[model samples]
Target: MVSKILIFMLWFLVWLLLSWPPRISSFITGALVSAFVSFMTMDILVKDRPSGRSPLRYLWFVYYIIIFLWECLKANIDVAWRVLHPKLPIRPATIKIRTDLKSDIGLTFLANSITLTPGTTTIDVDKQNGYIYIHVLFLKEGCPDHDMRLPVVSKFERILKKVFE
Candidate 1:
């Protein structure tokens, strides 16, 4: 099927990129692995194959990567500071936030992005309501009353809407 071929190409490209300077042996091995893996996982790995993404979506994806890296750096610094400070200024709490993205792929990317950050972990996703519960190592001083959506989450959700939704 077309999807299986696409998956094989994707997997082979990743193999070549990661195992750079692909020698004959590695190239042959990657082809075999890619073919086997793609065939085996085609049905379950991606339930919905989005059809014909706009060029703008690719641009948004690139922007999302930049934003994600910047947010990740900030989170790393904040976590490191908390660890080194004598007071360990941390008020860990779980808060619910809303996302606009509706597609399963979009939600998955958003949740994974949150979990990948240093200080936050996505606890649960309410798919029907577009709500995510996230555990944060440090909540804002008045977080219980204030908007619970962190800027990183908002940025990711926004860009992901353009990219995936």
Candidate 2:
């Protein structure tokens, strides 16, 4: 029940922030619509409900996202430099990695994160078997290897663990 209320409030807040109201009526109408939509969709839409997250945990998640963005930016520059250089330093390979997370949402987040990164893209997810197939733009010696132990785990997985585990 509490989650439902939070979902509605969050949706309303997002709507209010994104929409500019020239008049009070529009503002009220938008908020009401957002609330109604969230209320109706909450049960059906939300797949994972992470338990026992403190306020500090959310801060950690934000910090991780910031760090990830910076890393991604650096990767983008490196990839672009390689692309424009005359050598055309390119090596493409596919990597398969196993994930310990046992939920659909976790796997989806991991796959999306790989795709969002500059040099990697998620090709397929075998959810039942808990594996991810990723295509990497640059792989030396035609071998794709990523250390998936701790910090090397996809950044989104870390947050999803906090949110869903």
Find the candidate with the highest TM-score and give its number.
1
Quote the RMSD, in angstroms, for model 2: 3.0
Residue 65 accuracy (lDDT) in model 2: 76
Estimate the TM-score of every prediction.
Answer: 0.83, 0.79
lDDT of 1 by residue, 26-136 (tens): 899999999899988887875665787787998889898988888888888888999999998888888898778888888989998998786899999998887899999
Model 2 quality (TM-score): 0.79
Question: How well is each residue in 1-165 modelled by candidate 2, as lDDT tens digits?
Answer: 777777778877777777755468767887789878987898786655566667676676676678668767877897889889998988877778777778775577666667766678888878787787778787655243355322344556766676545
lDDT against the true structure, per candidate, is 0.85, 0.71
Off by over 4 Å in 1: 1-3, 17-21, 50-52, 142-148
State the lDDT at 77 in candidate 2: 94
Per-prediction backbone clash count: 0, 1
- Pairs of residues at least 3 apart in sequence or in different chains that clash in candidate 2: 50-163
